[model samples]
Target: MGTRKFQGIYQLHYEEAMGKIQTGDLLFCSGSYLVSELIKKASNSFMSHVAFLFEWYDRVLVFESVESMGVRIVPLLHYMTNYKNTGKKYNGGLFIARHEKLIDSYFDQTLLKNMIRTGIDSLNRNYDQTEIIRILTRIKLGVGKHKEDNYEYICSEFVDYCFQQIGVRFPRTMEGFIYPEHIAADSNVYPMFEIVS
Candidate 1:
């Protein structure tokens, strides 16, 4: 019989490092590219105090030092469109850590506002959520374009939607949120974040 080799064991062992997050967290979410660009452009911006970048099994999330506000950073996978429930697949992306601590800084009003605005804006823009979702599904089947052209406008509207939700001033130049659903992983788009308390 020929010699068969099984999988080798290595001494190096790594554990999954998940940031402790809880409900009632105050998160300052923005686009991944926008934050990175701002950091590149403004060396002394508020993001200068980034402790570490957090990578989840799905998406890439960043962390920043928010001075007295505790830890804050932008959430990944937050695209400008309402693609989360479209029955499409989005691969992994970036994320921000210290979710629980961030939520402690502000009331739940902000998160609620952001979600509401996003949903409403899509409706107001004459975007049939069901139809758009169906189109996204068709695109995945290679039947049509990914609708990349509409992405820019959708993203722009998303920013406005978010602002309307929080009713607070955030960086205008910010971009999109990185979510796992956008990656075309599979039919089910996984949520990259849990509420941080």
Candidate 2:
């Protein structure tokens, strides 16, 4: 994507952005840390992580797998504020992306509720350390095999799996090698808005 196009995308405050997110929307984050830096380098994209949105009982939650937290649901506002407070130096910060086709074809109150339940079903699963190591090793050595294991998940894999549950598949050449850049670059998804702070 061009810098000018990215710059022209709508920007919103965290709170306002949270209010606008709908279930199944993708949340791509540019984290401020060493690991995030490594991920950006490996993927060659601005976003290092991705999550699926799930709004429940007036609170919006993000479903993602992190090295520290594994598969879990976190309050969306809390996630954004944590980054906003700490990631002053990062560019593109955090942004929301929506699959235009999915929104038009699959999004509805009932479908969203079901999607949230799908995410809830996978809570507490461990983060896929083997996959992370494999990805890093591949990026380092420039050769390795990519494997997909659902017993645990990395962030993008979790998002990919959730969408698959609803019959929407994000593109992947290899089964388990979904990266943040893959989702960001998907033809089906488009940037809606970004959070500046």
Candidate 2 segments exceeding 4 Å error: 1-8, 83-92, 105-111, 174-176
* Predicted candidate 2 versus true structure: per-residue lDDT over 54-123, tens digit per residue: 6779888778888886888877766645633563334447778887755675356575666677788888
- Show model 1 residue runs off by greater than 4 Å: 1-92, 97-102, 105-118, 124-152, 173-197
On a 0 to 1 TM-score scale, where does candidate 2 land against the true structure?
Answer: 0.85
Among all candidates shown, the one with the greatest lDDT: 2
Q: Give the Cα RMSD of candidate 2.
A: 3.2
In model 2, which residue pairs have backbone atoms overlapping below 3 Å?
Answer: none
TM for every model, in the order presented, reads 0.26, 0.85
Instruction: Rate residue 157 of model 2 by lDDT.
Output: 85
Q: By summed lDDT, which 10 consecutive residues of candidate 1 come out lowest? A: 1-10
